[model samples]
Target: IISVGALAGMFTMMVTMIYSSSRLIYAIGRDGLLPRWFGHVKGHLPENALWTVVLIIAIMGGLVPLTQLVNLVNIGTLIAFALVSIGIIPLRRHQAFNNEGFKVPGYPVTPIISFLFCLLLMTQLSVETWIMSLIWFAFGLVIYFSYGIRHGHVAEKRIE
Candidate 1:
């Protein structure tokens, strides 16, 4: 039963991650942050975006060892979560949006604790993982500045 549960959980995570990653690429392309080809659809599917994501994943999986991949994924997940937690503080401060449903109980305190915990966990990872994450982040920054910031829909709209 334990093995079965673990297998199910792993499959669920894999499927959800694939879907989410493909959609993210599609959204970015649609926003003009990436090549317009990435946003192209065929048969009601974001085929180009999905193919690009799959190819990237295949290359990464082929190049990196399984253990390193696990470490990278873990660090990436933690960092994303930490960013989300940190973002909530500023979002809560802004009164532009209506608060209709649930709100975080402790506001700043809760997010602060979460961010600290994520950082602590990140510190426990290997130096190689940290370096790799930083490199990827730098690459993202380069992409954003070189193409995303200028060609992005929001930026274009703001200019006009």
Candidate 2:
């Protein structure tokens, strides 16, 4: 029973990750940050992006050690959370004032605390994980500057 339950949970998490990653890839492709082939849709689904995600997952699963993969995911998630927590401050300040939406109870303090905690957690990750994450980020930066910046909708709007 315990083994079955664990398998089921793992399967569910795998499916969720695959779906979300595919959607992210599709969105980036649709926004011209990635090649258009990834944006292809069929039967109301981003089939190409889904397949791409599946292939990537399969390759990683086969080539990468599970512990390393887990660590990388942990660091990546922590970094994303930290960025969001820090980003909220600037976002709130830059946006037009509106009292109509949900507000953070402690405002800046809450977000600052959240960001600091995330940073602390990230520091606990292995150095290899940090190096991998930094390398991936650098690659993303290169792609964004070389192709996405010129091909994205924002660039088109700017030109017009």
Candidate 3:
């Protein structure tokens, strides 16, 4: 539907995702949650990983429109956020858990704000976006429950 310099616009958007996502993955690696080698690159040379990310992005973008891709990512991020928020209430309350680092500026309020934000975003999604998001989330949920949930430290803590 978009006719004016669409390729350039989408490429610009893709760069944003690429940069933010790479930094996120690097952070996870630094925290020892993901593979340390991801953060072990020569001054942010997850350069190799970026190539893989670009290849996948090209494949996905080639197959789907930019709008759809954005919506799908939104859905995935929303679900991820929901799961993490759900964790805080129970997990962070434990006396044995480490309580280092910064706390929320306002107890309960910050989470409520975030929940509303996600809900607002979900509301903005189109029908096609909702469907695609459900499909992607379902696939990820299946894998997480089958593999990641069983192996994850957070999951193990929840079980204990």
TM-score of each: 0.88, 0.85, 0.60
* Per-residue lDDT over 1-160 for candidate 3, one digit per residue giving the tens place of the 0 to 100 score: 4756787786686788888777766665555455555565665467645665677788997999877887788787786786666566666666776766647666567776787787787788899998877787687578656755554445334534
- Give the TM-score (vs. native) of candidate 1: 0.88
Per-residue lDDT tens digits for candidate 1, residues 101-146, read 7599787799999999999999899999989989999999999999
Query: What is the Cα-based TM-score of model 3?
Result: 0.60
Q: Give the TM-score of candidate 2.
A: 0.85
| Model 1 local distance difference test score | 0.86
- Per-residue lDDT, model 2, residue 18, is 91
Q: How well does model 3 score by local distance difference test?
A: 0.70
Pick the TM-score winner. Answer: 1
lDDT of each structure?
Answer: 0.86, 0.88, 0.70
Q: Give the least accurate 10-residue stretch of model 2, judged by summed lDDT.
A: 151-160
| Worst 10 contiguous positions by lDDT, candidate 1 | 151-160
How many collisions per candidate? 0, 0, 0
Clashes of 3: 0
lDDT of 1 at 132: 91
